[model samples]
Target: MGYEWLALAAAFLWAISSLISVTPARHLGPFSYSRWRMGCTAVMLTIMALIVGGWGSVSTAHVMPMVLSGLIGIFIGDTALFACMNRMGPRQAGLLFSCHAVFSAILGYWLFNETWHLAEIIGATLVFSGVVTAIFFGRKGSDNNDWEALHGKLAIGVALGLLAALCQALGGIIAKPVMQTDINPIAASAIRMITAFAAHSLFWASGAKLAKSKNPINRKIFSITALNGFLAMAVGMTLILYALQDGNVGMVALLSSTTPIMVLPLLWFITKQRPNHYAWFGAILAVIGTGLIVS
Candidate 1:
């Protein structure tokens, strides 16, 4: 039961890492930023695996799904998300991103035949609803990119957002059977990171496309992206695997949906202003949901 708390912690860690990534993502562009971040994460995970000597757990059965998880989740899902963010803005894109929980829950049931208890069902619903509410009416962006701005760009963003959700959900589902086994979550994360980083590297090397913003990858950019990669990829992803290793994949996925809600305090601290009171209620709802999920 206590292990469920790790999922909550993962939500916070991801929120922090996402906040830290804005500067680098803007500086290097999302694709470049993610590429560098993946490399840093791979290095971090590799070092940890070496120290623990847990690389021996990976087998032929675990390899393909883990690699495919990396490809679908990190490579395809994240790339689509970045594009959605560019077109729809973070808040708008996030509103759609919240749907990952629904996709995760459905896929977990359909693919793995995973079922939830009554408490788990109630808990996940509340958390998912709360996050959606919080994101919809939470922080007002500076540029005021309304979710209702349904232009061509917005349409594309919506489509990409859904696609990202599906990819992410499927990725998590794919990883569940492997993670539920005796494999170390840290090692699992390392394998996935290596897979994702290698794939992105090949894509870049192929010159299939170039970033919209061809900003030079400066040293500072590298440092920040590396930091972000450590938090978001190394820590956050490890906790995700750890959660899924012992808990219901659907429940873990929904719990991880709290990242945006977790961002409220950080926003308040950074801006010297409070989040919308509406967000506080949403937070309360999510906490109650957490209780039910863990009960």
Candidate 2:
């Protein structure tokens, strides 16, 4: 499969996971949900690595990058993202999250000398434009353009969302050199998950953030959390590594940044209601832009 498909699959899988996750995230609080999810993923991936001989290829060199990737991307990035999604709905959060592509492109060029074409730039622009359109006009009522409807907490939420994007972008770039050496993407993802879980554990151990943890006791809720972790970390992050292995990092970010676009219809489906007019338009534009970039 092409990297574009991998990126798209990553986006869709994330969207599905997000749809399932928001409720638990709200109940457990973002950090708690993130920490536990990473823990689950760490265990699952560790088992996977043992099964697939991913451990044999590990080197001292790979360890640092994998850990850093996990810390930046999963620990910081996902924690902040879950908080942002809870503070602000996914609609606004998605638009802000698109900034990851720009951050990734700039960092990729500066750090790794990744280059882009005119067509790629155009496609990226369209993708962002579609995301904006969807977000601005896709809400249930006339309240579109979240950037315009700013308030005290909402503004903070937006900042958190942007921070999450930046971390995610940086994490992706940081892991690139290691992955380029032909490391198994699953192993790479698993290693990152372990490192991120370790980081989260340290944070919780500090006794300050423990107040934020809800400590899920319900088996069903725990199951949901595990499932989300498996989808996002096991499946989604692995696909992300696979995409970054050979795909233009910028294009991959832009293409996969369509999570918000995918989420609108998902929200409608879950809510049993029709999405707003602009959502459909934004979805189409995002698809067209992604297709163009691939072409």
Candidate 3:
């Protein structure tokens, strides 16, 4: 598959993994849950890298950038995202997370001299508009679903979500040059996971209150956390890195930002509640926009 398809695949995995992560993330708290996820994903990627002799592809030149990418992306971005999710639930959080596409596009233009065609720009706008429509107008006023519940200050949640988006964009941009090298994506992903895991380990060791778990760890929670790590970080992230190897950072980010659209159907299936017409309309817009982007 092309890089665009790879990015979309990553989006799909993230959509599934994000849904799986909600329960455990809420239980363990964002910081604790993020730490656990990084650790789990680190081990998984390290093993895969070793098994495939992918580590040999990594060079000293790639280390610093990958480390920076991990710290910015997984260490800060992911934790902020889950915290946003804790406050606003998946639907709203997903919309906010999708803002990374725009952030990445801007950053790519500024930092890497990347430019998108007019068609791509319009496509990106439509995708973003669809996200806004789906998130704001998709839910019914009468729907008192748990996913609709707001846990904390809406302002704080929105800030965190945007912060997550910016950091994620920065992370990808920082890694773009390294991805152009001969390094294996799996190896690059492993470095990122290990670096993030190490950062989380240090934070936990600092005995910060945020590092404490809100609920006791149970087998179910552990399983869910591990599964989320596998799909989201291990597989999903690897796919993104692979796409970044050849694709423009902005385009890859835009394609992957479709996670929100992908999540709607999964959300409907899990909640047994169909989305309103706005959701379908938004999905159509996003699909058409994606076609424009890749055409």
* Candidate with more favorable, higher lDDT: 1 or 3: 3
Q: Please give the distance, in angstroms, between residue 21's alpha carbon in candidate 2 and its true position after superposition.
A: 0.9
TM-scores of the models, in the order given: 0.91, 0.93, 0.97
**Higher-ranked by lDDT: 1 or 2:** 2
Candidate 2 TM-score versus the reference: 0.93
Instruction: Give lDDT tens digits, candidate 1, residues 1-295.
Output: 4657888898888778766766677666667777888989999999998889878887888889899999998888877776676566555566677688889988878887889888888888889878877777765442332322333565787898888878878888889999988887888899899999898898788785553335888888888888878887899888888888887777887888888788778756765657677778888888899889877
Per-residue error for 265 in candidate 1, Å, reads: 1.7
Tens digits of lDDT, candidate 2, 10-118: 9998888877887788778888888889999999988988899888888888988889888898889999988888777666777888789889989888887888788
Count clashes in each candidate, considering only residues at least 3 apart in sequence or on different chains.
0, 0, 0
lDDT of each: 0.79, 0.83, 0.92
Q: Rank the candidates by lDDT, best first.
A: 3, 2, 1
- Highest-lDDT candidate: 3
- Count of clashes in candidate 1: 0
Q: Which model, 1 or 3, shows the larger TM-score?
A: 3
Candidate closer to the true structure by TM-score (higher is better), 2 or 3: 3
Candidate 3: segments with Cα more than 4 A from true spot? none
Model 2 / residue 36 / CA error / Å: 1.0
